[model samples]
Target: MKYPIMIRVKQKQIAQLVSLGKRLDGRGLNDYRGIQLEVGVVGRAEGSARVRLGKTEVLVGTKIELGEPFPDVPNQGVLTVNAELVPLASPTFEPGPPREDAIELARVVDRGVRESKAIALEELCVEPGKKVFIVFVDVYVLNHDGNLIDASALAALAALLNTKMFNYEVKEGKIEVKPGYKPLSVKNYPIAVTFAQIDDKLVVDPWLEEEQVMDARITITTDKDGKICALQKGGYGYFTTQQVLEAAKIAKEKAEELRKLVVKG
Candidate 1:
C-alpha cells in the first residue's frame, strides 16, 4: 500500500529532475560518477583488479590453467567468464544458485572482451588440438550500486592487463614450467559505457536510484580502435535513431577516456 505510493513519488521526483538536465547526485546527463581502480589485489590469482564506481564495487580475478582446446578452435586458447552476485551485496540478491541477472552480467562482460579480441588466444596454444591454456575470469560483485555491466567490464579488462603467464618450455611433447613469469599478451582494450533513459533524457552511468526510475537502458562497448564491439539493451523502452547515434558518439570518447585509466598509457 504505502510502498507503492512511495515508489511513485520517488519516480516522479527523479523524472522531474532529469527533465531539467540534472541528476539527483548533482551530475550532468553525460557525466559519470568518480571511478577508482586497483590492480594486483589478490596475490594468489594470476591477475586481479577491483573497481569502485561511485558506490558500486566489483572485483575480478584471472586464473590460468592447462587444458585441452576445442576441436574447432584447436589452435586457440579458451576464455571462460563467471560472475557471482553475493547476497550481502544487495538485499535483492539471494543465496541460491546463479540467477538470470548474474548470468546476464557475465555474458555482457564476456562479449565486450571476446568481441574486442583483447586476449591473444593463439599465443596460448601449446600443441594445437592437444593442449592449450584456459583463462578463467571470475567477477565478484562486492556492492550493487547499479551499472554493474560497466563496472565489471572495467575490472575484467584491468585484471587481464595485469595477468601474467608462467614461463615454460616444451620438452618432448610436454610443457616444462620454469621459474619465471611473463605478462600476458594483451592487445586491444575494451571499455563499456552505459546509459539510462529517464524522462526522455539519456543519463550516463546511472546509479541505483536512476536505474530504478529509468525507462530503458543501453550499453555500448568500444575497442581501442574506437569501434563498437558489443552493445546491450535493457528495460522496456526504445531509442530513436538519432539517440542511438548520439550514444555511439559519446561511447567512443568515453571508452578512450576510461581505457587510459586501465592501460596506464
Candidate 2:
C-alpha cells in the first residue's frame, strides 16, 4: 500500500509536527474528534443507531428472532455480529463479500459486547434447551474518515441499548410470540477507544490522512467499571508494555466520556 508522493510528503510533515506536540488538524496529541450519536434511526429494525465521529459515520441495526439454542449454550440466547464496508463509503472499499478488515471489525465489536456481558441474554431464553432468542447485530460503514472500529462499536452498543424485543409466552410446551414489546435487558456499557501511533506520538481518534500515515493502531474496549474487556491491535508496528498500560488508562477515561453520549437513564 504505497501512498502518493504528496501523501508521503504530508506524512513527513505530520510526523515532524507530532514530535512538537502538534497535529495537522490542530488537535492535541491525545484529543479525540467530535462524536454524535442517534438511536432508533431505523424504524423497521428491532434496534438501530447511527454514530458520527469526526467525518466517520456508521449505522448499526439489531434484529431478534426465535431460534434453536446452541449445543453448548442451550439455555442462553445467541449473539451474532456482521459488518459491511460499503463501496460508497470510501474509495478503497470494494463491493463484494466481507473482507478481512470487515471481518475483524465485526469480531472486535462482538468481543467487546460478549465479554462485557452487556446484554442479559439469559432473560431471552424461551425454553431451557429447545428455543431461545437470537440477536443479530449488523454494522454498516456509511463514511470512512478513519477509526471505523470505535465508531462501529459505538453504533452497535447504542443500537442494543435501544432494542425492544417482542413479548413471548409458553403454552402446551411451545413458545408463543405475543404482540407487545419490552425493552431488552441490558447490564453494562462497554465502549471502545482507539489510538493511532504516528512516529513516537499516540493520537486519539485518527482521521483518514493520519490513519494512512500511522505506524500502528490499537483499540481497547472497557466496561463501565473501567475494566478492559477486549483489545485489538492493527498494523505491523509494536507497542511496549508501558505503552499498552498507558493506552488502557487513556481508554478508560475516553470510554467514560463516550459512554455518556449513548447511555440513557
Candidate 3:
C-alpha cells in the first residue's frame, strides 16, 4: 500500500492513458505483467519458491514440524502462514513488529489457501489429535512494486506444492523420523488475482504507480476447479456493478494462467 512520489506522477499519466483505453506499460486494461517463478531456491528450507511479477518480488518458504491438532479439528493437520516486510526490501519498511499492512498480507494469503482447502489436513493426522504435521509457510517480501497479495499467494502455493515431509513413526507417544520422504498432501491449487480501480477504470495487475492512484482494490481466489474460494476487497473506492462483474471475469482468466504455471512445477 506504499506509493512513491514518482509513482503518483505515473498514476496521473496512467489515468490519462486509461481514458484512451490504453495502459502506460502498454498492456491492455485486463493484461497482467510477466511472471517468473523458481522453486526449491532455498537450500535450507524444506520447500521454497521465489516469484517475480515485473519489478515486484516475493519469496516463500515452507517448514514442517510435528504438533498436536486443534481440539475442534483433531483429525486434521494445521497450516500457519506468516509474512514479513523486510526493511532491506524497502526503505519504507522498518525492522520492528509487523505493521498492519504486513498482517493483512499474511491473512489474505492464508485465506486463499485455507479457505480453498488446498491442503488436505486430514491426511496430515499422524495419531488423531495427539500428533500431526503442521506446515508453516512464511512469506518474505524482497521488493515492493505492487500487488503483494497476488505475488505472496503465488509463492506460498508454489512452496507448499514443492514441500516434502520426512517419514516418521509414532512409538509409545514419541514421534521419530525415519529415512524417507513424501510429497506434501496437497488437494487443490489456489491462485489469487488482484485488480485495482484507477480513475474509474478497472485494471488487472496494477503496477506501483497505478496502485497509488487507484480508488479501491479487489482480490479473488480460485481453485483448480475454477470455483471462487475467497474474495477480499479494500480501499475507499467504490466499483459499479458492471465493473465488479468484469473484474470477476478477468480474475477467472488470470487464475487459469497461474494455475498452469503452478502445476507445471
Candidate 4:
C-alpha cells in the first residue's frame, strides 16, 4: 500500500494543511466530501444502489431468496453481507478471494445494519422454522478514495430501502411465487461516519491523500435515534478517550445529514 515518492510528499503537505485546520480539498475539518446516491440502479437485483463520495464510488445489491432458517435461529430470517474490492478500483486491490481489508469492510457494514435492527428479520419469515427469506447484501467498491466503509454502508442501507420482496404463497410445505411484490420491511436507519487522524488533527471523510498519511481511522455508526450501534477502529494507531467521544458526537451529527439522502422520496 505504499504510494510513490510524490504521493508521499503530497501526504506530508496535506498533513501540514490539516494542522492549520484546512484541507487540501478546501473542506472543513469536520466536513464530508460531496455525496450522490441513486437507488434501483440494477434492475435484476431485488434492491440496488450506487453511492459516490468525492472520488470514491460503491454499489450495493440486495437479493432475497427463500431458504431454510438456521437451526439456532429457526424463527427468524437470515442476513448475509459480502464485500468485493474490485481490482479495477485500485492497483493495490487483487482479483481473488476476499482479503483482510474486504472482510473488515463487510463486517463493519454488517455490524451497523445488524445492530441497528434496520431490517425486521422476523417479519421476513414465511413459516416458523422451515421457510424464511435470506437477504444477501453484496457490496462492490468501484473506487478507493479513502472511506469505503461509510460509502458501502450507505449504499447497502439505501438498497434495502429500495428493496421489494417477491410475492409468494406457502402451502403444506412448499412456497410458490406470485406475480406481485411488496416493499421490504425496514425498521431503522443506521449511518456510519469515519474520521482519520494525522499528527494531532482529525478530519472527517478523509480523501485518498489524507488517508494514506493518517495515523489511524475510526468509524462510528449511529442509528436514527442518535445511539451508537457499532464502532470500528483501524490502523496501527490508537485514539484517546476524549478523541473517541468527540468522534462519536461528530458521527451523530453527520449521520443525521446523511440519513436524509437515503430516505429521500
Off by over 4 Å in 2: none
List per-candidate RMSD values in Å.
1.8, 1.1, 1.7, 1.2
Candidate 1 structure lDDT: 0.93
Location of the lowest summed lDDT over 10 successive residues in candidate 2: 1-10
lDDT of 4 by residue, 220-252 (tens): 999999999999999878899999999999999
Q: Which of the predicted structures, 3 or 4, would earn the higher lDDT when compared with the native?
A: 4
lDDT of 4: 0.93
**Candidate 4, 17: how far from true, in Å?**
0.6
Model 4 TM-score (2 dp): 0.97
- Per-residue alpha-carbon lDDT of model 1 for 56-157, expressed as tens digits? 999999999999999999999999999999998997788989898899899999999999999989999999999999999999999999999999999999
Clashes of each: 0, 0, 0, 0
**Residue pairs with backbone overlap in model 2:** none
lDDT of 2 by residue, 203-241 (tens): 988898998999899999999999999999998788888
Overlapping backbone residue pairs in candidate 3 total: 0
Q: lDDT of all the models against the reference? A: 0.93, 0.92, 0.90, 0.93
Question: Ten-residue segment with the worst summed lDDT in candidate 4?
Answer: 1-10
Count: clashes, candidate 4: 0
Residue 118, model 3: Cα distance from true site in angstroms = 0.7
